[model samples]
Structure formats: structure tokens, C-alpha cells
Target: MRPFKKIAGIAMSLALTAAMILPAGVRAEDTATDAPKIVISVGDEQKTPEFKADETKDLEISLKNQGIADAVKVRIAPVIEDANTWPFVVEDMNYERTVETITAGNEVMVKWEGLAVRPEVESKYYKLPFKITYEDGEGKQFQLDRYVFVKAVAADKPEEKPEEPKPEENGEPEGGEAGFSNSDPVVSGGGGGSESGKDAVPRVIVTGFNTDPGAVNAGSDFKLIIHLKNTSTKTAVSNMLFDLQAPSSGTEAAAEAPAFLPSSGSSSIYLDYIPAGGTQDISIALNARADLVQKPYSIAMTMKYEDSNATQYESSSSLAIPVKQAARFEFSELEIAPEAVAVGEEANITCSLYNTGRIKLYNVKAKFQGDGIEGKDVFVGNVDSGATGSIDGIVTATQEMAPDQKCKMIVSYEDESGKASTVEKEFSLTITPEQAPMDMSQMVDMPAEKGFPVLPVVIGAVVVVAAIVILIIVLKRRKKKKESVEEEDLLDEVDRFTEDE
Candidate 1:
């Protein structure tokens, strides 16, 4: 009993001392002369602070010594309790800024820049908690915390109208992923009271889609556009990648994947980033297979993205596209400019290549081949559906070619798939033997088969005989004259000698 009484008495006395000392401590802290007034602003504008998502803004904080005495070694800093839940990012500003002393009734201002908002978040007000730590004149340290409200809105599209409000809720909040209560709105990025768990992830939803041409033609190229919306209010999504697949399942035609052309060297596209509540557009160029049935075809789209913390997520979408049938071709006429040509001579070949199918033919080319012929390839380029195009070529007959020969004309064309096909047509060629050069000596006895001219040859022979006879007569006259001159010289020499004697 004595020990119990002593213990009770000591407890009561200690309680009395605590009650008195706590009041003194509270009074010391409450004294107006020991504290300073502090204010925080965003630049010169301090009222109704607001900023857009993904924008960096500057912060200005001021400290005033409202006490009766100067405060020594004064220091202050701002802190955020929960960064993931807060709408803004706080940077370190105290390391480079400190006041040695703040005189009584004087004030000091501090500025910290580069505070940004999370992207893709809807317009809303955010409550951010901050802390300020400083010392009084008598070396008494004090710490305080407060909340600052900032409005964050979208940065672009001023003309856009706000979404309509839904009717009042009557039932329990809709269910969500595990660890989340049905009562709270689904917030994918913000770290609220109930959403602060580490497992919180972002979700991306498909809004809508469209195709460049409402209907596609078999063996044709078209474009596809897909729209996406980020449903996570607090998180910015990134590394957006998608895999576009044509339905290849179940039926025989479905067993093969749809034919998709690559864009920018790859079929899959990477968007890299999408802000919260923002929309993204993806465009892809594709080609429908030529053999596809004339009906709607299904395309499967798979999307993968990451949140602010680099957590990956996936979703899927589907679409049915319409297709039309392919084109056809027919050729009816084949003609050569001349019926006959001599060996080693050139002749023109013409053909009418008609498009009999419903579609056009592209890159039409024609080539000729024969046993002994030099043929040229012709290009008709493009022939419209139900239209006719002329394919002309020049070919030379070789020396080995016979009087009657067979030649082949090959017409090649490409389909929408870029596959090449050829059609071959056979035609008869009448070749004449090459004419032999004229010979004057053999002209008179030559056969008519040779087609040699005889009148010119006879005239040439008569001229030659007349020239030979005239030449012989002139030679004889020259010999007679020479003999006469010799005789006269001898007689003159004899007369001169007699006169001298």
C-alpha cells in the first residue's frame, strides 16, 4: 500500500508539471515577435494561380521578418508530401538560396523555376502541400506546412467545347480493378488517398477510327486512320506502339494474313507520347490483296503503351473494311504495216491490246521473237479498263530469214499486286530474198528471177567496143608519121655534107 501511494503521488505531481510546462512551450511558440510571415506566388501574379499540363512555370516565395528583433541564420524550404498525387512537380530551391539574417520589419523573396504539369490531364484544381522551416532570433527552430491550390487545364484547342455532365449518381460507385474502392473516381496516375498503392497503372482507350476511301478495290492501295484517347487523368502515356493485323483465322481465306503495305519502312508505328485526356491519330497505308472476295474484311489492331512510371499496358481494337473486285484484259487485233519485206530490211508491227477486264492494266510491254529477226520491245505503259491501246514495234529481217516465216509477239502486263503476266500471239511474215547488185557483163543472159535490167547493160557494152576501135586507129596513124619524119632528117644531113665538099 505504501509503494502504491508513493507511485500515485509521483504520477500526479509529474502530470501537474507537464500541464504547466506545455502551456509555457505553447506560449513561446505563439509569441508574434518570434515568427515571420511567409507568402508564395507564381511570378508577379499571385492570385488565382493556374497552369496547363506539360508546362513549366516559375514560383516566387517571400519571407518577411515581422518580429520585433532580427532573425539570425534564417533558412526556408518548400516540400511536397506526395508528388504522385500532387498535380505539379516541385524542384529544389533552397540549396542555392539562404539568408544570413533578416532584420526586423524587412522581407526577402526567393524564386524557383521549372515546375511543370502532367500532360493529358483534364482541367481541375489541385491541392499541393508545402513546408517551410526557419529559426527565430533566440535560435528556436520552427517548421510549418500549408496547402496551395492550382488550376491545371489543357494547353491547346481553345475553340473546343466542354463535355456535357452526366446525370446524378444513384447506385454504388462502379467497380474497378482490385485494391480500389467503388466509391472513388478512377484515377490512373494521381496518388490520392485510396490510389497511392504501387500497383496503380494507366489505361488507354480507342475512341474512333476511319479509312481514307470508304471502299477499297481488290489489288489497290488505301490509307487507314485510328484515333486514341488517354483515359488516365493523372498520368502521361508514352512509348505508344501498335501491331496492325489482317484477320487470318477459321475459313480458308482467313487462314492467310491480309496483305498490308509498309509505311516509313515498317508496318508498326511508334507514337512516343500522348498526354492525359488527349487524343492521338495514327495513319497507315495498306494494299488489299487482288484475290480477296468482294466483301468486308476484318482487321485486328493491338496497342501497347507505358505510363509516367514506364509501366507497360495493352489493348485491342477491330474494324471491317469493304473491298471491290479486280480488273481484266483482252486483246483482239494483230496487224503488220506491210505484208512483205526484203531480207535485212526493217518493217513495222502493230497490235491492238484491249482491256477486257473491269480494271486497268499497268506497265504494259510488248516484245517480238522470231527465228531470224531483230525485234524491238514496245511499251504501252497503261491501258484503261474497257479501252484499247496500240502496241507498235520495228523489227529487222536477218539474212537467214526465209520467204515465209513465223514470229511471236509477247505482251506482258502487271496487276495491282505488282505480279507480271504475259500473253503470246503468233503472226506470219512474208520475207523477200535480198536483191543482188547489178553486173553489166552478165546482164544480157541473166534470168528474170534475178530481176536484172538488160537495156542499161546493152548500152554499156556498145560504148566499150567503140572506144577500143578508135584507140587502135590513132596508134596506126602515129607510127606512119614517125617513119616520115626520120626520112626527112636523113635527106637534110646528106645535103649539108655535099655543100661542105
Candidate 2:
């Protein structure tokens, strides 16, 4: 029994160890077989080709599928940087290109022609970097970065030659057609390597430009017309395309391109062909941002075209257009009439506004705004460029206001684009307590000064006279008693006289 238990325990330990070891081996194998392999390089003939300043050269790149999977939609482009130090620039767009497929053990080669180099660059070896992007059969994409060094050589200068004949009668030169100016061609090759006359490559030039409103103002939409001319006298250009490139650094303050302008993705216009000595005019609508400065801003234009036999070429030019600043105002000489206001009193304020920019302002208004204060807004109508205007309003102070308090005076206006702006001017306030009103009804009810009463004395005299009348009546009664006898004698005399009558 002990031997059996030992055998079973040993078998269990072995099985656990096998389970752990097999997974690591399987993971290693899966990782090794998961991804595809590819090889890319600059062609052997192009690896050490001589590069010249102010000259265009063709670059050949080769790509090979080294793994079992096929590559799909293989994209290739060149990326150059450090323009201050890099002696060469790819004059054509190198963003994207596609190849349908490259099966296992298969390879593909591509050519990038007409790369321009600076004229003043010295002879040296320069590194050119290229980016290749592709996907496998499962649509999984991958990117590879590769580079090659090229030697730059000094270009030989062209030999001096006799000048051409002047324009003859009927306005035509000896070797040129009528209406052709005797002045130098609008576009000329910068490189000294190419021979003069018929062997020279064709070029594109911007001959003239104009704006719809005759001027460009910040925050305004305007039309831009450009006249493009081909400088080649013998080669006609075909499949011509035009594009505008905006600066990335100052894009927030740059002029904007409408939907019609090819600011991104594709070219704005594609002409079937531009004949030799012919001109084409293109138009674009642009809007200047509000923050654009009052100076000339550059808009870069790039042209891509092919010659009569389908050889592609590209060139770029810039146009500097002046921009006028938008309407901007400042609060100057802000006067708070009486400086401070008393509670429950009408306060008056005035402010002077100055338009410091070239744009005009409309519906200019100023008013006093603060807690416990009320005022009306004063309208100054419109103010012209570099002009001054004044606005005044009245406000009433509330009881909550305190002495030496501070409040803001807000001046608002609109620019030519109907954009509103406000300038706040803070001023100190002196608030006083409200006075109490006088009461006239209380004065009418007030007591008179303390003194002897004349009416009371007159009443006392009437009472005394009544008492004297009663006493006199009593005294007269006593006298009548004494005079009874005399009255009887007079009565008897009267009776006798009556009988006699």
C-alpha cells in the first residue's frame, strides 16, 4: 500500500510539471509565426546618386515581400524636417500612394521625381527619410521608417550667351509670338545646372492678385482672385491642380478658407491643360478671423501639373495681403458727475469712447452698473474709425449703498460684424443717509405759551352780574313791602279817577 501511494503521488507531480512546460513552448511558437516580414530600401542605382543645390533629382525606392503573407494597399511617402539645416525639399506632395498587392518573394519599385534642393546648399552627404505603410491579407496595417544618405555635388553654372532680339514691329519678338512681352519670364528655374533655352523645365507663376472689396478687413468675408501663368514657351502643361496651404502656427489668427477652397485633402481646381504662354485665373472666398493683426499676411499657393508627355511637376508661391484691424474701443475720460451720489438721489455719469482701430462701431452705448444703483443707458449711435464719441446716463442710488463704495460703469458697442464688446470702468461712490421730511400738521396741533386766559375772566364776570341781579331783586322786594301803603293810596286815587272818567 505504501509503494502504491508513492507511485501515484510521483505520477501526479510529473503531470503538473508537464502542463506548465508545454504552454511556454506553444506561446513561443505562436509569437514567432504571428507577424509578416518585409524588406524595403532605396534602389542600388539611387543609393549614392549625386544631389545638387537648386536642382531636381529622381529617387527610386524598392519594396520586397519576404514573408508568406501578401502586402496590400502599400503606401509610401517621404518626410523631411529641419528646413533650416536640411539642404533639400520635396517639391511634390508625398502624403500617400497605394499598391494593390505584393505576393511572397515579390518586389515593387517606385520613383519620386523632381525633388528641389536649396541653391545655396554646400556639397555634403544628406539623409532622406521615407515612410512605408502596408497591410497583410487580414487587413492588419503596419508602418516602417527607412532612410538613405545621398551625396550633394556642386552644380556647374550655365555659360553666358548673347541676349535675344528685341520686340519687332507688330509687337512680336524674332522667335516669339505676338503679344508676348520682352520682359523676363514670370517663372524661372532656380538651379544653375539645367541648360538655358529649350531644354529648361516648365514653371508656374502667380502674375497678379486682387480682392473683391478692394481691401481685406479683419472678421470679414471677401473674394480673392489669382492669375496663374505658365512660363514654358514650348511645353504645354496638363492635369493642372491648385491648392492653398494655411500656416499651422498662426492658424488661430489667420484668414479662413471657405468650403470651396482646397484647404485640405484635395486640390481646389483641376484644369484639363494650360497651354504654353497661357494664363488661368482662379477665385477663392476667404474670411479673416477676428484676432488677425493689422499687417500683411501670407497665403501659400502650390500648383501640381504634368507636361505634354505626362511628366509631373510642382511649384509653390506666396501672396502677401494687407489686413485691417477690427473695431476696438477704449474708455477715456470717464467722468462720474458729482463723483459720489447720495441715497435716494439721482446720479449722473458720462464717459468718452475712442475707436482706436480702423473698423467702425455701431449702437455705441454706456451705462452705470452696480448693486443698489439704477441708471439708464446712453446711446451714442455710430463711431467712425479713429473717432471719439460721448455717452451719458442717469442713475439713482439706493439706501443699501455706503459711503466711499465702488461700482462699475459698463460701456458696450458692436463692431461691423455685429459682434458685441463691453468695457467696464470702475469708479468710487460716496453714499449719504437720506434726510427725513418736515411735518406741517404737527405744528397746527401744538400748545400755545402758558399765560392768564381772557375768555375765563369774561365768563366769571357774567356769573357775578347774575348774582347782583338776584340781590337787587330781593332788595327791591323789601322796598316794595315798605311802599305797600303808598301803592294802596295811589291805587285808590287811580280807582277814583277811573270812576270819575
Candidate 3:
């Protein structure tokens, strides 16, 4: 019985030793009460990688159970290394294993979907460390640490492009683009302000003008007419005035001044509101002086006016007129008397001088010049512009003059313009002699000289002479008859007596 008890105790001891000498991995939990039986790892063992400014990526953690039993109630917490000091943002965080019950020979994956890595933190790299806690079926907790590493990579900075230049105006390059230094006057000449180039202010133009009477005698009244226009993009205004002056050598006289009217005449016409592209007309009158010259004179017309903003503008024009001499003198016919007067006897002759030039002829002189005779001088007084004066004078023939004599008469006078001139005319006269008379009886006895035929006188003379003759004959016959009768009585006693006898 004692021998059989020893063999049973040894066998029990050997069995006890075998149980105490089990494998270290299977006995690890019993040897250390706080040691974890499982360890967790990530796909990447280095620092977490950086993401681009607009990029997104996913992160994953993998776990395996290498122990003798299963792992239960596993929890994982992800921590950012230096995240509070960096400018990175974690947009999302997700876990694939919610309540993982990992078996000893199995593996699990913890996936983070749509997990964003913050773009370019203050530092170049970023790190994410993970800690996992789990419990075995014995109710003891185990902890594991894992990490990830990343680098910034300064994501490829893109290349920049340059800008292009603009073209210049006037077909020329601007600034240094022309590749030449600009120092010439033609290239740089310009006036400052709004008139710099093609942009400039416009001007008003005067298109037309006119005047009247044109021609006038000295001292006569006349009128002056004017025309004005506004040829511009703006309105125009002006005042009209005229000046009349005589020639240098003539009278120093001017026309009478003119009166002012509202929109016409010498007065200032406020053409203040002439619209763009419109026109207006103006006219005036003036009287010339009496003493003006007998030649041409000048008239200068001018216009002055103000703009809408009270700016003044002016323009001018000149014209000429002729002055003529006034008429004052007239004439009659030349006369001479006693055409047959003897040369020794004063051959009487007479002629008249008439004033014909303007203005009275003061101290007028007249004389005759010829071969056979000497002339006497005649004088007259003022004759006025339209008035007439005359001179009656005689001229005698010389003692040596023959039957007929001729002479030239010259007249001189002064005009109103202080000028003098001469005019000439002609005259003639004749010379002859005289005789005496005698008695009545002889004149009566002589036969009368024959003259131009007088019909009644001749007829009467013939009749008287015939009657006398007849009477004489009758007397004679009667006497003779008486004698014969007496004789006849003797002879009648003889003849009538002859016949009777």
C-alpha cells in the first residue's frame, strides 16, 4: 500500500509540472495582468502625406488578433499631431469597425471614407497617430498605438505667362516701340489743351455783303446797305457802323451821322439768338456833305456785336463813290453890225460871254486874239453852281484892216473844286463907203431906169401913151378936114363939087 501511494503522487506531480510549463504566448495574460494580448497597425508606418489645396483622400487602419482567444469590444481613437498649431482641417472621420469581435486567426480593416487632409499647413509635413483599446473574454482591457507620416511636396507651382502690347494711333508707334529718339519739331509740335490734335474748336465765317448808290454827285445824299450772315455751328451777334472820308487833295468833309434803330440801321442789333446754320440782314443810310470833293471817296463799314456769353466780335468792309462838278453856265449866238462900214470908220462888233462852270466865276476875264485887230478885256463876277452870268463887249477893226477881218475870243473861269479852264470862239466884220443926189426937171425928162417887173404899173403906162397919140391924130385930121372942106367948097364947088362937080 505504501509503494502504490508513492507511484500515484509522482504521477500527479508530473502532471502538475506539464501544466505549469505551457507556451509563453498562451501564458502571457496569466503572467502579466496589465499586458495587452493584441496589437493594432496601419497600412502606412511613416508620417501622414499632405494633400493639395483642392484634393481629398482616404486613410485606413488594419487590426489582427494574434492571441489564443478572440478580441471583443474594440474601440479606436485617432489623434492629430500638432493639429492645433497647424492650419489643416479634417473635413471628415469614419471608422469601418464599430463593434469588432476579432477572432485569433482573423483580421479587420478600419476605413475612413472621404477623409480630407488640410491643405498646406504652417509646416511642411503632417502626422496622425491612432490608439486602439479592446477587451478579451476575461474582461481585461488592451491598448495599441499606431501612426502615419506625410510630406508637403510643395505641389508643382504652375508657370506664369507674359502680357502683350497695344498698338498706337496715327499709324505711328507709341513710346519706345518705334525704336528711335523723337526730338524733331514736326514730330512733337502742338498747342496744349483741347486743341492738341484732330480735336479743335471751330470758327464762324462771314459769307456775304453789299452797299447802295453806288455812284453819286458831290454833295448829294445816298444810302448804304449791308448784309451779314452766320455760317457756323453756333449763333452770331454784331453792331453796324460806317465811316466816309474824302480824297486827300479834295474837301475834308464827312457824311452826316446816322440814327439808331432796334433791329436795323446804325444802332446795335442784338442778333443775340441766331440759331445754328441761320442768317440775318441789316441796312443803313447816310447823307454826304455839300463841300465834298468832285472825285471818288471811300466808305468804310464795320460791324461789332456780342456773343451769348457777352463776348464781342467785329468785321469790316470798304467801298468807293464818284463826285461830279455842278453845272452853272450857258450861251447865245455871236453878232456883228455895219457889215459894209469903211475900214477907217469904226467897224462896230459885239459878243456875249456866259458862265458855264460850277460856282460863281469871280474876276472872270475875256479877250480876243487875231491877225488884223487887238482885243479889249472883259470882267464878270460870281456865277454859283447852277446860276448864270453874262458879258456884253465890243471889238473894233484896225485902220490897216481891209474888207473882211476875223478874230478868236477866249474865256477863262474858276470851278468849285478850285480848278480853272479856258474856252474859245470866233467872230468877223466888213468895211465899205457912201455917196450924193440932184434936180427935178432933168430927172423927170430922163428916161426912168428899168426895174423888177411891176405888172399893173407897166399896163397903165401903155394905156396912157396910146390915148395921147390918138388924140393928137384926131386933132390934126379935123383941122385938115376943115381946110379941105373949105377948099372943097371952093372945090366942092370944084370936087365935091368935084364929085359934085
lDDT of all predictions: 0.60, 0.62, 0.47
TM-scores for candidates 1 onward, in order: 0.28, 0.31, 0.28
Tens digits of per-residue lDDT, candidate 1, 1-501, equal 475456455555655655565555445334423123322211122343568888888755566665466655654554555666666654453434466777776777766567777776445445454555455545455544433445567567666574763311121123211111112123333223233543354566656666778657777778888777776677778888888776542225554554444444466878989887678898888887766544456566777776766556667665556565555666666666455666654566776777866556789999999886766577778887668887767666675565466788998888655678888888877777753322222233322232454434544544554465456556656877887888888988899989999
| Worst window of 10 by summed lDDT in candidate 2 | 175-184
Supply candidate 1's per-residue lDDT for 213. 82
Stretches of candidate 1 off by over 4 Å are 1-327, 400-404, 437-501
lDDT of 2 by residue, 107-161 (tens): 7877666667778775544556667777766645666655555556556779679
Show model 2 residue runs off by greater than 4 Å: 1-201, 212-223, 249-268, 285-295, 309-312, 322-347, 350-501
Top-scoring candidate (lDDT): 2
Candidate 3's TM-score reads 0.28
Q: Which ten residues in a row have the lowest lDDT in candidate 1?
A: 176-185
- Candidate 3's residue-wise lDDT over 185-297, tens digit each? 11112223222342122123334334356655445555545444555455443332323222233332422321111122233333435444556655555555555434444
Candidate 1 at residue 153, lDDT? 73
Model 1: colliding residue pairs: 119-276, 120-275, 120-276, 327-359, 328-357, 330-356
